[model samples]
Target: MRPVIPYLVSAGLFGLGVFGLLRRRNAVLLLMAVELMLNAVNLLLVTADTTVRAALPHSGQVFALFVIVLAAAEVGVGLAIVLRLFRLRADIDVDAIALTGPDATVALAATSPSLTSPTCGTPSATPGAAQ
Candidate 1:
């Protein structure tokens, strides 16, 4: 078996993961791309374990397992945040979500006066609030 084959495959997987990460704007798709990248790393680790005669047997596999655990945790937290954002904004497009900059500051100031500095921008009172 040619050891180079696994390396090539791992490199391809990593490249695809990077492309997905860069191109996708949906929050869910972004998480999936991160998972893909983690999986690529796992693949590389396992392949290297097979290729190299390390003193500690299966250390790479152990590390791969750790990566899987980390990925699972990340997905859980990420999905929770995405769900909350969806509930709040009714949209999941990452490009539409801006946490900083002028637009965000203005929007935030309009929604809640306490969230923005008094000098930052004029806060608009919501409907039903006492004038």
Candidate 2:
């Protein structure tokens, strides 16, 4: 196979990740997008390590391992935050998040009716309304 194939696939995955990160409003989806981007980088790194004649043959693989570790840590922290937000507000829509001032929790509650209101999960106040 051509060396460029893996690079192109990696680029596509990175582009898809960026699109997902920008387009998604759910915190979990955003985290998944970040993981997608990290995997793309990992794929690129391993491909380079195997195909290129580098001074250190396993340098890219080592870096990819680091990225994997970082990605795992990131997922752990991100999920914790998401779970906390879900518990506090009963929702995980990122667009509804507005952490400002001393009354940060109240701010989100006041700004987004879908967050604290009775009709939160109903079609009357959809996640799109917060945006």
Among all candidates shown, the one with the greatest TM-score? 1
- Looking at model 2, report the run of 10 residues with the lowest lDDT sum: 117-126
lDDT of 1 by residue, 1-131 (tens): 57788888888888998999999989999999899889989989988887774677898899999999999999999999999888766778898776877787665455554664546345445679887
lDDT of each: 0.83, 0.86
TM-score of each: 0.80, 0.78
RMSD, model 1, all Cα superposed? 3.9
**Each model's backbone clash number:** 0, 0
lDDT of 1 at 10: 83
